[model samples]
Target: MSAAAGAEAWGLAGLASNDPGDIHFDIVLRGYDREQVDERLRFLGDELATAEQALAAARERTAGLEEELASARGELERRVPDPDVGFGNRVEKILRLAEEEAAEIRQRAGTRPRRSSSRPGPRPSSSTPCAMMSSSGCVAPRTCSTSTSTRPGSPTDSRGGSPERRVAWSPRTGED
Candidate 1:
């Protein structure tokens, strides 16, 4: 029944009827423990009320945590890049660029004059030797021994100062 209907039907009369002393019992050879039964009922009612309060508090906490979780998910969605749109577009653009570069390289190779021998040329005296990875073709090392810095982008002189000349080289394939 609705709260309004129940309130109209039953007032505070039920509260007065729960008196332990007024409870009726049939007389038998052995009588029931009325006092213990009354005490247990009171204890159980108190425990049920406490449990109901605890349930309400727990429900409120769960609602707050759920709201927090939703907001966190929203923030994460805003910050992180969409893999379908951004990543795929970037990959497609990179592939297109790489294809165009390959086409240009092939065109240049077709027009360029071929060398008679596949053997490596004589190494220059002033240049130092540096090894490349085994999977790729050999590279002619054009590093300067007098230079203080061997690292790329930063050219240095013998005294560990900035150098005027920059050493540069291209890798030649071992194949004909």
Candidate 2:
């Protein structure tokens, strides 16, 4: 019939003519020698033992490295200074800057005169009627009252007006 059928028929005829039990026993004895099987088993056992020893050695090395790292970190902590102990140095720096500013202010105040003397006459006293003239010749009438509502460190004659009215002092100008 077909090629597969023909091969299957031949295989069945060969199985019917031969004793299957005898063929299987002969194949098993030829494929497996007792001494060779024992030797292979012993070799596998030796390889497993070698692998276990290597694993143990690796674990011991890892543990030793961890202990050494901890010891080194402990020594470093003892050698380095603590940050909390440096607070006094920071306070000293702030106080030094404050003292320098105060000394500079005192020196400037001592060197400069209190009032400028370039005006035409004596400064207008409080309770006098004064008229302020603008740069464009526009005059505005202002009352000079002796009021205590004066700005601190201002040169106003108790009238909320200063002699240098046109001057605007700013720290960015850097002028004395």
C-alpha TM-scores of all predictions: 0.35, 0.37
Pairs with backbone N, CA or C atoms under 3 Å apart (clashes), candidate 1: none
C-alpha RMSD in Å of predicted model 2 compared with the true structure? 18.3
Runs off by more than 4 Å, candidate 1: 1-31, 88-176
Error of 2 at 133 (Å): 42
lDDT digits (tens) for residues 1-176 of candidate 2: 43223324544222221243522111354685454344434444665777899999999999999999999999999999888767877677556655764587569759987655343324444454433333454234544343232333345444444443122222222231
* Model 1: lDDT of residue 58: 100
- Lowest lDDT sum, 10 consecutive residues, model 1, at 115-124
Best by TM-score: 2
* Candidate 1 lDDT over residue span 54-103, tens digit each: 99999999999999999999999999988889989967766665576558
Number of clashing residue pairs in every model? 0, 0
Go through the candidates in order and give each one's C-alpha lDDT: 0.50, 0.50
